[model samples]
Target chain A: MDFALEVNKLCKAYKDTAFKLQNVSFNIPKGSIVGFVGKNGAGKSTTINAVLNILHKDSGEVAFFGKAMTDDAKYIRNDIGVVFDTVHFSGELTPKKLERVMKDIYENWDGALFLAYLERFHIPADKKIKTFSRGMTMKLSISSALSHKAKLLILDEATAGLDPVVREEILDLLLEFVENEENSILMSSHISSDLEKVADYIIFIDNGKIILSEKKDTLIYEYGIARMKQSDFDTLDKSEYLSARKRGLQLEVLIENKKQFTRAHPDIVTDNATIDEILPMLTKEESK
Target chain B: MKGLIRNDFYNVEGSMKLTMLAFIIIMIVLGIAGIYFPPNSYLASAVIGGTLGAFGALSGTAMQKDGASKWSRFELTMPISRSDVMKARYISFILYILIGLVMAIISALYFMR
Candidate 1:
């Protein structure tokens, strides 16, 4: 398949423990928003860092724009815009100073656009960054990232913990980026709600292993959560189930092919499960 | 590269103001308290060097802080090279150092007069 970014057989470990990212493999289609879903310490940040060459992967083949990332990481980086959850600027520097620094660094930095974003975000052009609030800091980083006209944006939990309004604004911006159909985004976020709004594809990882990767719409349609009696679940074919668990008097089952399963078993009431419900079951079943 | 350096230069917080002030005050104290002689090239050179060190330190710390910030991760994802990002902060430091030295030069000239 033609991919915008590919992580093939990627592996990494931190602090001499088990793998931080064990055999992670997935492809991000060009111009699509790929959501990276994982809990804390699930190797989401580590995966992003490896792609950016911030932390070296133990072994893997990463290709971007159909070129080997290891061989041409620097070249690939020029086209990727990265956004993280924390502020990256120094407390002392003003936006004006940061612009000057970035202009010299990025070959394609746009000073006018950066200034416009700062103004739109209501970030004071001359105020010290130390005084800026968390939301302001995030906005500042985004303004800087977008000004360079990046084709790929890698956002690591960029919207986590943000207010709904702020998160909505960011999601709109991400959607705007994807509207070009020449830009792709790989955003790693714990809040699946954020991704649900913007992601075209979803990759669910847990405890260093990737569990599921599929188009968001396909996942929503193909996989359904059914609450059935425990005895009823036993009567159904086990192969049709992605996962099943009993809680009190309720039995929840994640079906592999919800439409087909629904046709086969008309008696069962099938309902769509959110990404949050899908993740824990997928990861737990995979781990088991 | 050039843009990053420029950003660091005009930032104007501790790098430009506080550190510069501290450097100048220390230089003046050293010149007046113990070295009670008429100001000369030696005084100018010492003050400039001190001012450079002070501002240089501020910018250096700022660069490291930048590395840890959200911008660091964001910029890293872009096509720009990490080396370029790292280089921007250093160039910014050099700019701050020069700004401090300029102030020191003016102070030394005033003392000589």
Candidate 2:
């Protein structure tokens, strides 16, 4: 399958800080929504910065649409729309005036689509952006991102501060974007529930390392947590579980195939593992 | 590139007007000074020239503001190349210098006469 984005062995480090993106790699297949899930300092933004070339990488290969990214990769950028956690628009200009600015910047900009989004979001065209509320500003950013005929969207905490209703609207918009089957999205969000709602695949990053990258449905459905007493857990093969944690007298084991594990051992109770539950377990150190 | 330039223009619109108003006010004061003190008439032209030159600084100031503001981050995410951004800054500065030089020349001629 043709991938929309591919990153291989990407690495970066800061002289002032100990944090580094350690050999980060992932792929976004065409027509897929990939949710980049990580804690705040889990190198999500660093990985994105390296991909976007906003920050120089120590070593790695990043390809967008099968083309290697170079200094003159402006052509690739036109097809990509990005929304950062902080929405940035000129405070002095109204959304109407900002459209004039965007029209000249993007070759495939759709003015009518932009205006329609603004109207749908109830964002006044004439009001200066400085006066807009946080939710309104976020909506405006989303409108701009959709206005351009973007094939891929790279959003970093784009829905962080918005209320649930607004997030639902944005989620619906993202769902619509991927309906064309020629588009993809790499959205890094803190809200796992939102990712659960829209993402087809999930990538978990922690301490500059990618802990897990798998199909969301597979991760949530096929994989499960096997809870058992320490004496009962001792008899099971260690290789069968990805990782396990000892909670008091019980052991919570992360099994790769919950169904198979349950079939093999009918007595042990295996529960569905959520992205949220799996994330922390993966990051936690192994128990002796 | 044009879009970036246009955005910059809109951002600096109010500042540009304020700078021009300051220049005009300074010229008026210099002209009145020239009328009262004939020996300082040449000095009036110098001050007027200096005021127009000061207006040239506004473009750089505007560019600096744009870079410092949150807007810079968003602009970098756009499809435009880094060279396009550089070109936009260059165009805005060039326009600023040209306008300043023209105003200074006109003021110098009027004051000298």
Candidate 3:
């Protein structure tokens, strides 16, 4: 019941583009990692920007630790750490210089911890950020975010474009971060396998709307994909499946509960759904 | 706010050093030229004017770098308010102008002698 972050009815629109975030809402429970999964341009970044007040929302309420984010509540941001797809610090700055910068910005900045992380991650302390490779830069970003002693981390594709080994390292760091029971993470990434490995909850966004928000286990274990003939599909009730698609006279239906669906139709078979399969299946068009 | 101003200065530090180097070189050349041509002694004044102009542009360069790297957007996520960010920029701009004024004054004093 205790939530680290709560977003409600968040809406944002751009005059130059047709894309807009529509009634986007989610909650990150305390000590839980919530994976925000969406295709590119699906309003994930826009929603994150709105939450951080980088983009003005048309209508919304975003709360951190039960305190609404308002002009007077700007101090709440000190407890939140953010890492975007690219390193936001200037290329001219070295990690050593960045420490001085961050120390002044964050009230809880841990200089020794920052140095330890840099050493552990094998990031050079004196090299300019421009000289770092993509993986090294990402590692540096994560190190900075963690060193701030932030209670909540909002990472927008932080692990993206890195090699599998580096991604695994970052995931391990995240798992370690949430072990404190006072920390949480909201990571928006297109990679579902990463979410499958670490996320407790998954929120799927598509075309500026949130289509699915559920426990990762429920999605993976209870949700099922049923393949059957047209005659067999007609016997099933509409409530049994979320969406259905027709392929060469056979129908593939996305069922919400695999056990119940099988019990209801003893002959029909259902396969467990992964986050990757569930996303497209949920958004797939119903067979005509 | 201190952090923001410090970052702005860091962003422009390279260009600031280059500008100072150019100012020193120009001031030396023009100072010698002024000593030789007493009647047409406007060479030092030209160097002073050019050096001060370059210093004024350093703040703009800092802002341009922030824009290019999207640091402007990233900083919004920090604990500072929007007005705090603007105030830091203005303060840094004033500091830049003050540094230029000091250099100009030193050049002017040197040329008078």
Candidate 4:
């Protein structure tokens, strides 16, 4: 498979501070929405910055479309479109004026498309961006990013503050982009539901290490929250499981292998896993 | 990169135009004030440039705040490179600064001459 973004042993640190990423490696196949998930300060932002060359990594490799991401990166950038949590449009200009400015910057910039998005998203072209609400500004940001026909879309907390309706719409639009099979997305968001909806793959990180990275559906099925009797838990092997929590004499186990464990211990009741459940269980206290 | 520059340019929105207009108005006001209550041309020029320069100097720095924000991660997902985003911003800054400088020069030259 042609990988859209390849990260290998990517590492970075802030002077004397703890390492931001530790030997993190993953491959995002072309035309895939890889959900980059981790809690706040889990180095999700740091990893994305290293991919974009925004911050210099202490050690590692990031490649986009098979091209090495380097500090001297130039032409490779035009292929990506970024939409962040905040749209910092200069308070000095209007979107109308920006259209003119952007046309010169993007070789494939589509004016008609940008204006169409503005209209669709209800963003006023002549109004000052400072007057826009958070949602409006984010729409404007996404409009500009999409209008340029970039091959990859990178989002960091872009939907954090957006209402669920708007967030879903944005996610739908991203799915539309990747439907063509040439476009891919590496969306970093704390809003797990958004990623759960559209992402094909997921990489969970905590304290600078990749705790779990797998196909979304596979993860949801493989890692299960198992509810069992207090007596049932006494004989189960702890090696293949993530954790166990006791509630009112009932025990719940988060295991990596549900079918095999179930086969061996047929009486143990298993519950379905969710994208949300996998992260905490897999990385919970670095489950032994 | 052009798209990003344009996006970032638009993203920062009203502050740029409002600030530019405010600068031009101040320069013109000072220019006209000098004509009636005439001060030294050099001092008048100094006052006009100084006020406008205060905001102008902040253009580069203001945009960098986003780079240090959550949006910096958003920017990475796009096909654009980091340096290109910065370059587009740098160009936009130069363009706006030039526009402001010209407006001041034209206003000052009109009165000083």
Best-matching candidate per DockQ: 3
Docking quality (DockQ) for each candidate = 0.48, 0.66, 0.71, 0.33
Q: How many clashes (backbone N, Cα, C below 3 Å) per candidate?
A: 32, 0, 0, 32
Which is superior by lDDT, 1 or 4?
1
Instruction: List residue ranges in candidate 4 displaced over 4 A.
Output: A246-249, A286-288, B1-113
Report the TM-score of candidate 1, chain A only: 0.94
Per-model TM values vs. the true structure = 0.84, 0.93, 0.96, 0.81
lDDT string, candidate 2, A1-288, tens digits: 488899999999989999988889999999999999988799998898789887788999999999887658888888888888875887878899999999998889999999999999999999988789889999999899988999889999999989999999999999999998989999998899999999999999999999999999998889999999887888899788888888888889898899899988899999999988888778886664
- The CAPRI category of model 3 is medium
lDDT of 4 by residue, A4-31 (tens): 8899999888887865688989888988
Model 1: per-residue Cα lDDT over B46-107, one tens digit each: 76777667766767666566655545555555455667766776677667667767776776
CAPRI-wise, candidate 1 is: acceptable
Question: Which tens-of-lDDT digit does each residue in A230-287 have in candidate 1?
Answer: 6788788778888877668878888868889888888988899789989877766521
Q: Model 4 residue A19 lDDT? A: 59
Cα error of candidate 4 at position B110, Å:
5.8
Which pairs, if any, clash in model 3?
none
Model 2, B67: alpha-carbon shift in Å?
Answer: 3.3
Evaluated against the true structure, the overall lDDT of model 2 is 0.87
Query: Residue A212 in model 2: shift from native, Å?
Result: 0.7
Tens-digit lDDT track for model 2 on B1-113? 88998998888787888878877887787677777877355675676667667767877777676765578767777877678788888898888788888888877776766
